[model samples]
Target chain A: MSDLVNVSYLAVGPEILLTLGAVLVLMIDVFRQPSARVHAWIVAATILAATVVTWFQWDRVTGEGPFLAFSDMVVIDEYGVIASFILLLVGALGLAVAWGMVERLGRRGAEGIVLVFMAIAGFQFMAVSANLVMMFMGLEIASISLYVLAGITRERPEADEAALKYFLLGSFASAVFIYGVALAFAGTGGVSVYDIGAFLRGSVLLKPGVLLIGMALLITGLAFKLSAAPFHVWAPDTYQGSPAGIVGFMAAGAKVGAFAGLGRIVITAFPLYEAEWAVGLAILATISIATGTLLAIAQSDIRRLLAYSGVAHAGFILTGLTAGEAGMPAVWFYLAVYTVQLIGAFAVVAAVAGPTAAGSPMSDYEGLSRRSPFLAAVLALFMLAMSGVPLTAGFVGKFGAFAVAWRADFEWLVIVALVASVAGFFFYLRVIVLMYMREPAVAEAPGTMRARLEPVGALRWVLIISTAITLAFGIYPTPLLDLLSTALPF
Target chain B: MTELVLFFIFGALALVGGLTVVAARNPVHSAMGLMLTLFSLAVFYVVQAAHFVAAVQVIVYAGAVMTLFLFVIMLIGVDKAENLSETIRLQRPLVVLVGLTVVVVGVFVAVGGRFAWITGVVGAGPEVNGTAEAIGDDLFTTWLLPFEATSLLLIIASAGALALAFFRPRRREGKEEGAP
Candidate 1:
């Protein structure tokens, strides 16, 4: 029993720090002066500590069997470690980037910081979930937090509308997810995955009555999370309505948690139904690739454009899901690439501000090549990386993703991939031409243009780090691949 | 037997209340409909043996989320005239979208999601601790990293929400109201 207690403490120690820190930050902000900006740095430090702790566990880790502690509900494994680490790092980046971005807004409400911590914790819950109940709880935590974040601007009806839509859809999807879990429970008479797995090998549901219905519901829930085609209607509006920094974090960090969590669910629970679900995933991949790229071409709003681009990126990630046994590691590596590149793009976009100036506009980027070549060049690097240009992380990530599809004998998907990649290049390059070739909307005070257009110190560093990592991984992706390969037992 | 009864009752309430929320003419009435739907959902949680979730559903959702909705409705000052949509985009047909989505999800399943391995994961177990304690153990132990890491996301959500609330970037001019 003492041994069990030790194991539990060892695993959850990082979460304890985070939860306590988040609650404390909120309480302190309430009692102390509202203007106290103490929690940003403190939150940053606490997350950093948690990351260090997670890392320490990584080093001292001895392989152990995945267990269902607490009456057999959840499992702990290397996959959880890898996914959680990414979440921590990204969440910390969210705070770090927001430090400047929020200050730029000049409304110092620490509760906003507190809410983000809660959302991150909620997403982490999804990543580690085993039972449907846990999954539902985590989904609510993430979704509700997102709805509030989406509509926080009371004056903007568009923001309000976006929140309402996201909320309504989220609740609807939650219901669908729960109903699926219920159907699964009906088939198995038990709520545990282990019990379900045992029953599925040859159960009454296996005869194709109730069990089949249950599986479809489960996949639907996961699809909404992945933002794969058909279920992806909410992506553009939600991202466009959200604040730029939040959209960026949601794009990268949220996907990392959701995809990893969903991947675990698919692989662990539904391997027997691969033939049935795999085809659906394949169709989603094709449509997601084609539709995501084509629709992005029609967009004028920059945020909306990125949001659509995310849809296409999700398609590429879905290819990993369809690659069957061989593509799992690629899924992991590709997600990491997608996260970094997105953060870099949004960071550069966010950094386009002056002391008293309004938010960044596309027109502000006109002729940026002449004003500050560095910013232009940074944006260019991120765009190029997104386009899967050689020597950038996007290339290797795409290659890794498609290679899995190839291994699955879906070579046509590769052709579709090539077509999508070629098609995607135009939109990404449009940004380049706009910055370098087009002229700024208005001439700036000579040095003012340069100073104003400069990147935030922290965000600039973040972008630089992300850029370096993208390049490094592009040039040498084996390290990431090796890490992902070792992180899961598949 | 009691569990089944509770499930049936909540399921009936949820179905009827959900329908009412969608069909009601008055926005406040719709909000009330939403409340009933939420309450039914709480009862559903109880039937599932998720006592903690049921409590949260009542407190956080039915109590807090519903109250927040009521407050928003009041602040917006909805009346008979305002409840009506002025544009063609928000006509009655939009109601069908929800039913359509459910059907689509159903079709995906009815067709077996077109994969064999996805036949469905079913299990048999000696269930214990229901939902709360089991989840508590699971979350605190093996799943601790992901659970803790979720805080970072909450931080992002909070910052984003706050920025939206305070920044008030003008959609057209990029400046706030009355600001030079």
Candidate 2:
């Protein structure tokens, strides 16, 4: 059947590459002595190669899969292409960090790479999912990997606790999401966002309970992914427990892909039901800003603080989500900016946080400028960007988010954002003050961390590029704005 | 209709399964209850005509995942788990309260939709095929950028996780091994 061939050709390009890479890494891990492993790097390189190949094949109509397989559940598209590339790239970075980290933990093995590829593959499926069935499957694949990943360092009890909590809460959220999908399917005879959008375009509401309940449940599930208020309870614990590198990976890579999906669902498919969902979203946004910022201020632990800070930023992104047509491009640009800034900040933290179990607390940053002014300055720039100060990438992201919102007649949302920005400044500034302005506490632990503070590695260089772009965009944002102009969910 | 009857059966199973997952004293019992819950979920997926998804739900989630949970319980040695938390904590009350609140909120939100702002204005009902062709047409034409960007994002993640998880421990601290 042509169907079989088409499906193979269409889905096989990226899917086969990822699946084979994952399987290959596993097989090789079995034979290679743990002490003499080279397969991890090979796996990383192969993934990049596969992604490049997939990118080149983007000349065709992007969503056109080879055949209608999986019961028409998945489709390849520009969306899928972008998602796949990002997933693979971020996965490689995770591999590199793990390469350094595994030696630190004294656990050299193949399971980590296998799970990473598996998760990347899962995220790829999610990007291409066309129906509720595929979407749920994709989500499960990604989530299962992450659950195991949280506890990969099986030696750490906190890792186990974090994974357990993440697993349970994630499961509950998945159930709610699927239940909502079922109801939505029942109500509209449709499961995909586009299909739902078509059905809702010119109709008056019926069985409103089904739609409203579905939206609420779906939002609850997505809120957990976004790590927004109320549903964000698991983030800090999980982030703290997981390896610092994994924290960076999830915060940047996962957030971008997840938010794209969320934006599509809300702005495109469910816009017709704005009457039911809009107010709730606004309330959530407000709460996220308040709770996340306030909670972050109380955290002495760097990872926990970043986790809460991540929550507040998600609220900022939610504002764009609420802005409808005007919000899409803004949200996209913000996500890209957010991803880079976060990666840079986490890299610095991971590199410089001094010799404590969870690395140095916020207090350890004391006189970081004196120790490594170069590192402190780099981090300070990122923190300031996070604060949305002028001449930085964060400002452009925040400005775009607000501009679109005001254009969409949500001026009050804009005001709240302004206030939150000011409130957020206090915490970021405290980090800076401790680094440059204040003396470290007297009762400090021994073994001062003396790793070279220069941004020497490829990863560090990558962070520098992101920081430079942030500054460049802040000064002349027109190029990015133009690119954003075409990214639409309006 | 068979559809109506099937709904009630699976719904009942799901409800009971949920209750047992929460109330079971043993960790293994809870895991089994969760498995039942997941199975009921697959049944619902099957009822809804998602064959592949149903199979995945049963095999991947219920079988593979539940096995892991049970394994962990065994590894930790179920005896190590307390039948009940002795310390009076806020966890129990909070759990019960949140559980009841979901139900209450569900009921209210469901009923309240009748009074929805666009109740009289929006009127289309579910009848579209939602097949691969339909979704493909829309996605290829409209959702293209997000599609590609998301894949790119995931690829990056894959490399990073692999690098960390499979990373040879000898790169950075070749000297750490020499420590006496």
Candidate 3:
């Protein structure tokens, strides 16, 4: 029992450090009014320290296999560790990419950094927790922080609108999630994922009416978070209206956490009902792909376009899950590559549109190549990768997802995804064309000069790292694939 | 017979309160209706022998949350009536249809003779007494992680409120002066 207790502390070491770092940052900001740069340094140092702790936890999990901690409320496993790594990476990249906006916010910048730290810790808890109530707590913590971050630049009415819509819809989803938890408890008399699974495996229910409804509600709530189409109405408005710099992080971090939670709930806890849920997930994937691709073509704003594309990508990720546990490797790979590409693409948006700007009209990109060759090149690369062009990480991710879904007898979903992928190429390529082929709109107006666009400070590093990852993973994905193959829930 | 009578009375109160919350024109009246529903819920909890939960329902829902709601209403000013015109075509009909579907499904479940839906081994877990001691023991021991995690949620809520509501006076003045 003592050993178990120690392991539990070890399992949560990163979250503890992160929460302390958040409080420390807030305290330091209150006492000493420092530059946003100092807050960034503190946040970076905290993330680095947390990463080291996660490394140790990873070593222990890989050596000793997965173990339950804190009376099975938390699980220390490779799957959770990998998800944590992705979320941490997102936090770091998100902070760096949005550094310009943080600095622009002046004194409120520290609050932004602290919220990022708290949000990362919350999502990390979500990834690791094995109990339903614990997961819900983590979800709310992360969600409320994101809701605040959405409107951190309160000067913009659009930002306030985005925040209000997200808060209202997100709270409703959380309530639904807790309702599902209640129904599941009533049905199975257990709240721990493994315990519920054990109970289901041990008994055969003649009438699974309440349990089925509970599972459906749980999936619906998570589907809303994942922004799988039909539940994806809030994504476009929120992404378009929130400050451009941090939208990447918001989208990427939420997806990673939601997918991690969904994967565990479906693959670990409800595998007994896989036949039912897989079909349901496949139907959702089909609709998401179709809707995202079709609607993206109609969007004039770049942010709204990416938001729609993200919905389609969510569908592709869901397609992999239809293959059950065997498809997790593909899902992880797709998530990692896609999230980096997303951040990199939005980094360019931040550079071009100004970090605190809410909208990025496609017209803003007219002749971007002349304004800034580097930004245009990287953005185009991200676009190509997002559209799943050959020799890009996006292609490999989609291929892997489609392959798994095909093997799972979801061949029709694979087909629909392929057609959507082809259609997706249009909007992505249109961006490339506008950047490269068109003349600057300002150039046409005499006596007007459009300043050269350049990525400065942390945004430069974000682009470089994201681009490198996209290219390297595209050329060789073996290492990531091998690592993810070991990332199975225990 | 007394228990049934109490249940019916509180249930009626809850329904009325719920309808008023949706139908009342005055925001303050809606808040009061919400308080009524919450109080009725506490009564139900007490009737179920969940005295600890009943107290928490009254204290947290009726006392604290209702105060927060009223404060928001006061801050926003309750004089203006909310617009009830439909912004989307057929929204009212769609909502009614959805609500009807939920009611029908709930009724079917309740009267469908499926009360034995729970299939897990009975009494395999900790026993519940609905007392503070039993709840505290479970919360601290078996549910320690979730309980501890709730602290993070509270921290987030407070921090988020501060971040959104607390603006620096200098920036506010600058913005005001800069405005045309």
Candidate 4:
């Protein structure tokens, strides 16, 4: 009873580093109001340091079983480490993509940077935590930050409404989730994933009603975060209402964390009940893909369109999950590529629409090719990638996910997904055609030009890196696949 | 026997309080009913010998959270009774069906022996289970990560609240004009 547990802070190195950076930014904002550029540098340095730390952990940390630390609340594993590295990249690119907005907001923008750091830290925790309560806390930390980020621009009534709706719905989801956690704890007599898994493995209950209900509730809550159907009502509104500069970050970061957490729970803790969960997940995937793609066609707002598309993408990721533990690498690869493309697409949005404004009509993008050829071309590339065009990362990702689902005997779901993807091509290509082929529709105003494009600085770097990666991975996916094959979250 | 009687009384009060919360016309009345439910729940904890939980429940839920709710209700000026209109089509009937299903399921679970596994494993433990020291030990050991993570969550909440609600950025101040 008196035995001391060996605690290692190194297990949470990335999280600790990012937290310190968040604190430092907040303090700097208070004491000596730094410019957004200075804060960007700080954020960049912190992300680089965190990445280095993750790389070090990748090499240093190895064992037959997961090296659990902090009284067995967290594990230092390659799966989490690789995910952390990808999350850091997402954070870095997200910062670059939103730099214009930061500069626009000037002194107040430091909080956005801090919030981003906090969100990344929370997401890192979500990936690494082994305890249910700890995961919930991480979810809350990330979510609260997102709710505020959604309403960062209070001047816009839409932003206010988006924030309020998100808060209300998100809090409801959290309540449902915590209730499920309590049930799981009561049923299994444990809150840690390891303990719960051991308990379930040790016995066979004829009527495991509580655990089943817990799993269902848990899936519902995470589905809401992932923006799956029936639980995705708030997504389009929130995405359209939030500042254009950071919506991609918010969406991508949340998805990464949710997928990691979901993979952890489904693969590691609840494998015994695969038959039960896979059916539910398949249903969710079908509805999400069908509803998301069908509704995306009717949307004129680019942000809302992207929101629906994100829902469809969520369905594709869930297809990967249907393969159980065997599907984790595919999910990881898909998330890594998709999130980069998501941020890049939104960077273009931020450039076209002012960083903080809402109400960007699709018509605004007409003749985007002539006005700013670089932005138009890159945006088209991202759109093509998202549509799963050949020789793009999205194609490989969708193929991997669909193949895994097929191998898992979700043949009907694969057929549905294929049809949805083909239907998805129309809207994605519409953006491309509108940008290149159509002439810029002249505005009614006398002196005003039809469109105004901002001078993109750091965003260009984000676009270049994302586009390069998307094309590189599409043409030769073996390297990334090889790397991801080893990073399985066993 | 006295403890059992006290338990029944508090449990009855809690159920009635919950019904009042749903049935009350005025929002303020509903809030009052919520306080009653919370207070009764604290009493239930007390009966279970979870003195710390009982105290915290009273302090946090009945005292602070209830006060905050009342203040928000007063501020929003929604304390007046609503018309109880059915806005969405089929919403009332759907809610009724769902509510009935939930009630039926709850009754079945409570009466069924599905939860026997819990009691069989835990046994009828002694009063030491709910003591402050026992909770403290667990919090410092097994639950330490969640406890500390809570601070980070609070920080995010505060920072987000401030950033969203208060921080006002001057628009295009001290910048060159007509650049783009």
Candidate 5:
């Protein structure tokens, strides 16, 4: 309960910037009749500004004593900065891909952009949160906005269904997470991660029963968010049913936030009991990988296929967690690379289908190469990256995750992941095959059903940038690895 | 002796209220049972010297949150009868097994020294614990960031509600705007 308030202001500059940006966008949307493009530019500028603020915090974050603010409810650290930076990048890319959605929604598009900023701010808060209650608040903020965003196309019944399902399941998960925090508080008489860690370390309990249950519950709630199997039933439906434009942001931002929070909980709070939680996490990871790979093979819709792919990727990320403190950098790297590829793939999906549309069947992508070579090539590239092909970001990500897990003595889990990686090629390659090998269908009416690419200038930029990053990281990942090496949770 | 008697009476009331919630046929009756359970829980909190929590339980949970639940139920057509039959064949047996296991585990832990630590006060027992003044001081100082963040969370929620529920989508032109 320090008396200094100004330090807290400096610590939370990025979040403040995002919150003000969100408010400003909403205000402008209400007062001014600006084009959707204007709103997009404003959103992009806000994200860039937040990024700059995050950059300035880097020096302060990595400084001696690792600056904390608001009675240690928030911390400025390399871990939070890197995670927040990725989340903001994801937001910017998601907004770019959502350009068609903005134009399509017209006046109502500002609401979408506002929700995006709110979601990003929420996730950024999760990354920096020092207190358990603050973490829960951040999770709720992000998840609530995502649920509403999932149902943004109110005209579509599928969107309504997606929003309702996500809201119901997501609220239940949040309650479980908060209940775990309450139990942890009761067990240790502490709420902040630092306090809890000190308490756990100082105590020698004959029975550490309640705390273990709390940790298990905490992991379960985050596992649900990560879309790990056994709690992954909501993902495919939500991803397939929600509007195509913002699904990438929803999926990627949630992973970055949840992983950041979960990593903090496990590494910061539960290191003493690593043997117990790592075994449990390993089992969950194996299940998610196996289930995601096997089920993705049978998917008809491309969105559902990607949903399962996301599930497998979640398993890959959790493998990094099994390495305890040592695996964090790999976790960050994998999330950064995979999320960009995910958003890029979805950007292509939005380009082929209208942004607001939900379902995009596999047949819709047939002969995409002839229709638009650029879009088809980008989709294929992302698919190759997603499949962990050599000389792609996904390959390096998979290698880093597996290498860390193996070093942590989770060899059997690594073996399972290796098998799953081979299985992943089937579905990802199927999309590529549909795009390249198949022929475009003839229209019944003169030329009504012809394959014509949308004039999505923003999506093209997103594709180009994501593709370049994917390739660059794949070839020379030393810089990203170096940057992530310093991102240690305090 | 009087304290023990009060505990028994309130405890029995809470158990009955919980049973009523599960046994009631009507949704409104179930809601009433839930309120009874909540009120008895508030009494428990008060007995533990958590007066602030007790007041918040009554005001926020029983008063405001329950009202919202009832409003949603009414708005969504509470007149519609719900199916009481089990959808899954093994649901009843599974519920019974889980309930028995929970009760057994609860009794086991309660008989042990686990619950003893819960109320083991080092210095003060009841006077300063969970008082409004103590909570308010902590909220304003120790939890200042979370408090402000909570205000921002509320803003996001209200905005989400406005976007999702209030704003109506405009109809498009003749072009159905199918797959691009």
Candidate 6:
């Protein structure tokens, strides 16, 4: 028993380190009165340390094959390790991209950094949690931090609106999720994911009405977090109004964590009901792809356009999920490559619009190529990658997802996804066209001409790294695909 | 016989309290209605032999939470009555339609096939008692991780409240001149 307890502590070492780092940063800010640069360094170092710990955990788990700790409340497996790595990567790059905003916020920067740490830790917990209630707790931790992060610039009315809307809708979804947990517990007499699966496999339930309803509600709650269509009303407003610098992290992190949780629940706990949930996911995918593509074309703001595009991406990822356990590798691959592109694109937005600014009007991108060729070139690459043009990471991701979904007898979903992918190029290419072909809208007033948008400091590094990864993986995706093939939930 | 009588009385009280919460115009009155409902829920927990849970429901909900709610109401001033007027067009009709749909669904779920709401095997898992000892043992042992993780939630809540409510940025000259 003592050995087990000790092992449990070791298993959760990364999470503990993150939590400690958050508190430590807060304490240092209070006592030392350090600059925002110091806080950023602390956060970066903490993320680096956590990644190292996760790497060690991956080594152990791969050797032993998915170790459960804390009385099976958490499963330390390749799936969780990979998810944690993605989240940590997002956190590091996100902090770098948002560094200017943090410095501008002055004393409030420490709180923002702390919230990021806590949010990342929370999402990591969500990825690893084995109990339904534990997952709920993780979701709340990440969500509350994000809600505050969205409104960190409280003086901006748009920020306030975004925060309030996100809070209200997010709380409603949390309530629905917990209610589903209760109903599932009542229906299965179990709260542990593995135990629920065991119960379903052992006993034939004649009246699965309550359980089915619970499952639907759970899916709905997660879908809202993933920003799938129909539940994606909050995405456009939140993304458009949030400070530009960190929006990438917020969007990418939530998808990674939510998909991890959703994949685990559907594939591990409720695989017996695949036919039922697969159809539900298929419907959500169809709606998301259609709505995201159509609405994205209509958006005048760059941020809102990205939000709608994220919805479409969620549908594409869900297409992979419809293939059940067989498609998890495709889903992970898509998530990794796509998130890098997302962060990279938003980094350009941060440079164009000040990091603390609320909106990124599409007009700002006109004549970007003439101003700063570097920013325009990278942004174009990201846009092309998002559109799934040939020889891009996005193409590989979409292709992988489509192939698996087709084999799973979801050929129709694949067909719809293919159509949506083609339609998606319209909006994505529009940004590139506006950047390169069109002249600056304010060229009439030489005095009002905006300064050259240069990627400097940490933002430059973020762009370079993301661009390298995007292209590298686009050319040769075997290494990542091979790694993800081992990242299966036990 | 006494248990049945107690159940019926509290059940009715809970129903009435829930209705009054929605119906009452005064915010204070609605709070009182919510308290009554909470108290009735505590009674239900006790009736199920979940003594610890009942005690917590009373102390946490009926006692502490009610006091906080009343304090907030007092701070906001009770003279302001809640506006019951509908602002959006067709709002009332849409609400009624949704309410009717929910009622129909509830009825169908209750009366469809099996009358028993809980269809799981009753004694498949460990026998649970309502004692603090049993709950504490499980909480400290099997549920220790989640229990510890709850501290993170509390920290986030408090920190988030602080960051949102306080933490104003100092205005720099020429930068924030045009805003607000």
* Ranked by DockQ, top first: 3, 6, 5, 4, 1, 2
Top TM-score prediction, candidate number = 3
Indicate the docking level reached by candidate 5.
acceptable
lDDT of 2 at A291: 89
Q: Which parts of model 1 are misplaced by more than 4 Å?
A: A1-7, A31-40, A60-68, A105-109, A152-162, A202-204, A353-361, A446-452, B1-16, B27-79, B83-180
Provide the lowest-lDDT 10-residue window in model 2 chain A. Answer: A61-70
Error of 1 at A329 (Å): 0.6
Full-model lDDT for every candidate:
0.70, 0.69, 0.89, 0.85, 0.86, 0.88
**How does residue A36 of candidate 5 score in lDDT?**
72
Query: Can you write out model 2's per-residue Cα lDDT over A190-251, one digit (the tens) per residue?
Result: 78776777788856565567676777777777688778898899889988887665666667
DockQ of every predicted complex: 0.19, 0.13, 0.51, 0.38, 0.39, 0.50
- Model 6: lDDT equals 0.88
Task: State the lDDT of candidate 6 residue by residue for B39-123, as single tens digits.
Answer: 9999989887889999999999999999999999999999975677888999989989999997888678767953344766575
Error of 2 at B128 (Å): 17
User: Which prediction has more favorable DockQ, 3 or 5?
Assistant: 3
lDDT of 5 by residue, A212-285 (tens): 76788899998888899878989999998899999999999999999999999988988888998999899999
Candidate 3 segments whose C-alpha is farther than 4 A from its true place? A1-7, A444-449, B1-8, B104-117, B121-127, B168-179
List, residue by residue over A147-175, the lDDT tens digit for candidate 4: 88888887678888888888899989889
Q: How far off is each candidate at the interface, as Cα RMSD in Å? A: 7.6, 9.6, 3.0, 3.7, 3.4, 2.7
**Candidate 5 global CA lDDT score:** 0.86
- The order by descending lDDT is 3, 6, 5, 4, 1, 2
Residue A489 lDDT, candidate 6, scale 0-100: 85
| B-chain TM-score of model 1 | 0.70
Top DockQ: which candidate number?
3
Estimate candidate 3's alpha-carbon lDDT, on a 0 to 1 scale: 0.89
Q: Which candidate, 3 or 6, would have the higher TM-score against the true structure?
A: 3
lDDT accuracy of residue B26 in candidate 6:
88
**Total clashing pairs for each candidate:** 40, 80, 0, 0, 0, 0
Which scores greater on TM-score, model 1 or model 3? 3
